[model samples]
Target: MKPAVRTGNHYITGDVACAEGAIAAGCRFFGAYPITPATEVAEHMAERLPDVGGTFIQMEDEIAAMASILGAAWTGVKTMTATSGPGFSLMMENLGLGVCTETPCVIVNVQRTGPSTGLPTQTGQGDMMQARWGSHGDYELIAIAPSSPQDCFYHTILAFNLSEKYRVPVLVMADEIVGHMSEKVVIPDAREITLVSRPRPKGRKDRFRLYQPGPDGVAPMPAIGEGYNVHVTGLTHDERGYPVMTPEAQEEMMTRLKGKIRNNLDDIIRTEEYRMEDADIVIVSYGISVRTGLTAVDEARRLGYKVGLFRLITVWPFPEERIHAIAARVKGLITVEINLGQVHYEVERCAHGQAATYLVGDAGGKIIHPDKVVSLIQEVFQP
Candidate 1:
């Protein structure tokens, strides 16, 4: 593995690199429950937090873990928590709270297989849809998928910045493969990294409204004991942050929550297009599946196929527009994933009859192989 080069140093493994990135990004609060694949993230944070004057707490359960991080964030601290699928499920209620309250925090879901306890120690991108709608309400979430250890470090910092900027819970949707994979990650110097601080409340403390919009849709957050008696709730509220049951207030609040993400879609959406220009086939994949899909593209091209790869770095807010554009040009779209075709549907929807969409997936505790993906591409092009 090559050394990870960032600001000035290198590191190994995505989990450790993520911890170092968070520390460097000024993340001082971590609350989590230990689970396989993601447990290392919590462990690393536990060992490193004290040295950097940060706080790391192991909560009773994933629910508590989720809640604790939000509470800590309310204290004006940039906070985060890590969990696997089951633990992520446990955190959904609080996750909804973070959404409605518009709290800024990062939740790292290092995914493993399962409807329940499917594959504890294995990797899967099964949680892609859950990251968007798991909270059981209408909300928009920022989800980032990292394909390599180095990206894990950088995207983790980006995740924190987006969470603070949008005042929404940003999900760093990592998987067992990327989380455990050891690779070179460049650690940039602390001073060089651009860190975003939460917008603070200004103007008269007596007249301050917690939900009042700033220049951007995000409201300035004043922490507890900041001399501003700001009230926050899940219920639809006015600028004063008091609950308002009126339809107008409800509509206004919900639109802002959803629109804030949509309005800034360009800044939040990110993807990598490989050999897309003048290509006949495009493989859309993410997380560890993308690594295999990339190799498959190369193998297909070697066989004289005009194959390309589209890697989604930011999973949610779904990159629909870009996929739609590419779908029109490609001869066919193949989606290779670790599940029984979740993202495959997205590809089909975006293709909109422009191209054929194919699914190559594995749901039985192993990754879809590159050869299988290559074979699928060949089969699609067959006469």
Candidate 2:
């Protein structure tokens, strides 16, 4: 190790913490484009990656940045990139390629207010849905949201580990507040961190099955120069990784691609429940929205209302089972997000009339206040 990893506690912004976390997670390459709110992540990585013998490349644009990371992942080394809003939109084509190829990589979106530079430096959670469905085609991805700089540090590491373990593009959706806010963060020693690497091919090199999935629906990821004839492409392919254009090939390939993440829902999905065991009203929120939702929950509790928080850690896959189970007992669910109602619909669908679902959000620029969230809870639960 040339620069070596830095292990200790320090006060830092979320973007910086994330860059440090990537280094701790053994990330040796960062490919990204500079954009507001997200540039700090790349800036820190540019400085730190070299200290640890990693490479940082500033691509011409978001499209090339996304492409660069995928190319790096093929070498069996942990890789990552950061972007937000417009840049995120540009990366969709390559993000699909990452998903189809089962490439293990981390994408950090330091979300800023936007609909085309709507508020470059302001915060917004508008991209929640885009993070999930931005890319074309029907496929699944793992996305985690963090509300604090501390969460940013740890979650980025988790994002990389999950990416390697599941062999998919794992996204860390950190909004402007958390990305720019400074907080006390604890960086643990290297040995304390647990990282996952894609399973390696065990068969004879001459007879290797490039895309043959294991019992877990994930195939071993061989390094680029590992003597295996790995044919990687975005096209639908069989077990050998060669492009094949046929309905049968499409069905078989797509099924495994989505199934690998869906089938392991119990392991892939993560959520945080606060006093939900007996609460009549529950607040569903993620990203920066979690902060205000919890504030509302606390005030509701003070007023003697049975209110609890259902904060989402793993935003993608929607945590359907948990939402349904909670909705069954709660009197109402107040879905809180910065976007108008992207995640609210998902919660409502899963609730299925077991409980009423309501939304409290808007377009973005300024964050929704805690009082607004409290008022929504009041409307839903007021007698």
Candidate 3:
């Protein structure tokens, strides 16, 4: 069997790095259908998983791929899958199922430009909003954006840890640029890596309540064959995991589903600030756009504009409070993304008139240029 953690510096693509990250995080099952940009992730897993006594299956479709992982996750092992735009859409129903059942797993969406097969080989940050809201229901899940190959490696591990800890599916939102880009990634020793497993149910097996939350608003989980009477479904269920068709049951289920994430905002939300100690304008971005924002911030500084960059590492949960705080102090906020205005609207909504909000974005198919971002910075604030 191969080592779970390869434990060395190796030059690799972000897609391959992500596969390694999942393996290092003790992910034993990977079920996916190959798609452009994200194919390498599954390919790597297929070649490596069996060496570690893990399972890798190429499912018939994205829907089945997502369902396969959710089923595997319930078996008390870490599981994951990878896909791009259209496949992501195909998986939405099961994604909602994962949220409803509180299944712990990871889904990597290496995005390409799309409404429908727009650009299979290029990069786009167009799926940011979809990652948060594509699933139809009142639910909340963690979604993180990785900016580079190194980020992809570490962030995939982070995704697994957060998924297990929170008992909800976590997303690694990568664009084609980051997924295909090659760079140096350091995989830490197995002993040095921290892994989290879902909290197991304790006490009398006969009286177990599958959906009863602990003090932290998260329920302890048990595998199907652990001899616990576990009942799981997508319907509105009570603490016992039995379907309860009532307003109260729905409210109770929804509250717990959303509360776990909302109540722990401080832990779930993460952002990186660059040169914002004193600045009049702040550029807000995530994924590949952060790379553009970084360069633009430096150029804006050289041009004598007090500009900074606010990079969203955890894109969901939205980082509203931090962005609001920045908006209160800055004269304006510029959002750089590959979509016309998905996350840009969130930034604008958070600004709340405290500062003017602008968007430097494209329809897709390419990364936003640093020059465009710098120009927007200049337009938002004069010398």
Using lDDT as the measure, the top candidate is 3
Sorted on TM-score, best first, the list reads: 3, 2, 1
TM-score on alpha carbons, each prediction: 0.96, 0.98, 0.99
Judged by lDDT against the true structure, how good is candidate 1?
A: 0.88
Off by over 4 Å in 3: none
- Candidate 2 has its poorest 10 consecutive residues by lDDT at 1-10
- Locate the minimum summed-lDDT window of 10 residues in model 3: 374-383
lDDT of 3 at 314: 97
Cα RMSD, model 1: 2.8
Candidate 1, residue 170: lDDT: 93
Over the stretch 134-194, how does candidate 1's per-residue lDDT look in tens digits? 8887899899998888888889899999999999999998888889989888886676688
For all predictions, the C-alpha RMSD in Å is 2.8, 1.1, 0.8
Please write out the lDDT profile of model 2 over residues 1-383, one tens digit for every residue.
45445678889999998898888888999998999899999999998888778899999999999999999999878999999999999999999999999999999999988888888879999888899999999999999999999898889989998899889999999999999999999888778888887888897998998888999999998998889978898998999999999999999998999899999999988899888878999999998899988888888888788999999999997899999999889889999888888999999999999998999987887778889978877775762
Give the number of the best model, judged by TM-score. Answer: 3
Those runs of model 1 whose alpha carbons end farther than 4 Å from true positions after fitting are 1-11
